[model samples]
Target: MSIEHMEQMETLLPEWLETSRLRTGQGEVASYIPELAKAARDTLGVFVADSQGKTIAAGDYGIPFTMQSISKVFTLILALMDHGEEAVFYNVGKEPTGDDFNSMIKLELVEPGIPFNPLINAGAITVSSLIAGDSPEDKSQRILQFFRKLAGNDGLDYNMDVYHSELETGDLNRSLAYFLKQNGVLKDPVEDVLSVYFKHCSIEVNCADLSRMALVLAFDGVDPCNGEKLIPRRYVQIAKTFMVTCGMYNASGEFAIDVGIPAKSGVSGGILALVPGQYGIGVVGPSLNSKGNSTAGVHLLERLSKEFSWSLF
Candidate 1:
């Protein structure tokens, strides 16, 4: 079944990409980050990789971009591995807040005061504090190493241009870290945690890298490409649930309905999605919709999901 689906995808992807690329004009490139504004607004790309390491690609799939918030999913798993579920859950909640991913409104409104889920900025920041490392530098290096293993690409490294830009102008994120610190939710120093957070977000990858990483999650944490268990099955289950509930920020519900898959979207216009037990997909369309998702990328996923009956629900 999976082989047949991959074959069908190879046959049909080009046509689908062309149609989806038309939606790029309806959106705008994110400029608040300064560095992200430089991405080609009209560009659209996608890559799909199966467990066997085979891939089918289209459009600008080779273009490398920062992982952005997509790094949170893996960091959440790393936190779980470091501190265990009980400890990790105490610092982060499991529900979705309809608010923006970067919003701090819910932190004060809600009891226990943790971020709604690990995918959001607040929760991810808290998770960064939980990483088992001696210093911020050490933690960041560990995260890079882990990501490289999952992607099977040793060349993966930080896009320092984006990293320095975000670090310089990330006042809002710094505010969130201070708030978490005030609430006693963040154990590490605010700057230290933020450094780790920003460093991970700056890790760079192209579509193929993302697909390879997602393929590990698709197979219940086993990297089918090399038959290595990179994450526990339980951790992947928890991460995937969060992906469905909150990975797309406030637009998660719409994406779940339209694309019907566990997916995560980063502010840099990269989306990492998976068909459980089947395929892993990576998409990039810098032009974003109002909810901060890739406009053309989301449309393309919707088309493919409907055509392939890939929805889990």
Candidate 2:
């Protein structure tokens, strides 16, 4: 980013964030996960970073939250890196389901019995199973190490409170895994796969960490900070495609029309977005809209994308 652009953002972000924060009152923090319900519903924050590492931040950018479904994007990329596209796609389809992120309606209605896409809950569990490891602990460790590398932060670790909460309350996930097992789509034990899945979702991060991770994708798998190839270009392509199609739960099409960038949102109220070769953006607002997206976070992204003409379309 240019110096002038950086200055512009620094001046405007605070005002813009306050405007977006007003929308937080219109939504509520996610309560289904028990632990996610602990977030402060009215808080909002954002961090934006460029390939050269220039950063602009505002609001509660330092507050920590779990990655939730946002982790699914990197997990899918890791699965692709482990088994290639053909092998990974054999277990999950690439199309959006249009149902709730956790709905199993299509699994029963759709043919082949595999998930419609990897970003959804069932599909993410399937992808978790595909992560190469001798045990669930090993698979979870691999995912953590990969995320740390992508974020340029080795201190990244799981919020075990959230992990145990999800594990205890993840009945729907267990159902999905058992169904996949019955359909011959899962090879590992159900609990083992859920262990890996829950652990990844519970990985905690703040806005800066999310921006650094998104920066790698913004530069097509290369870490501009160290000139390292963190992920294969082809796998990044697949991950970005999924983010466009299913990243915002079922509100993806609307997000694309309004913000026009690849983004993934987690129920923890975090959204990781990228502007191709330009910037990586991270947003958080614990208050969630009806579609399970961060209300203030979405509003903020729309505002910035419009002001900067950041839409890919």
Cα lDDT tens digits for candidate 2, 137-201: 99999999999999989999999999999999999999999999999999999999999999999
Candidate 1 per-residue lDDT over residues 1-313, each given as its tens digit: 4668778889999999999999999999989899999999989999998876688999999999999999999999999998899999999999999998899999999887888899999999999999999999999988999999999999999999999999999999999899999999987889899889999999999999999999999999999988889999999999999999999999999899989999999989999999999899999999999999999999999999998999999
The root-mean-square deviation over C-alpha atoms between each candidate and the true structure, in angstroms, is 0.9, 0.7
Off by over 4 Å in 2: none
Per-candidate clash tally:
0, 0
Find the candidate with the highest TM-score and give its number. 2
- TM per candidate comes to 0.98, 0.99
Worst 10 residues of 1 by lDDT: 1-10
For model 2, give the 10-residue run with minimal summed lDDT.
1-10
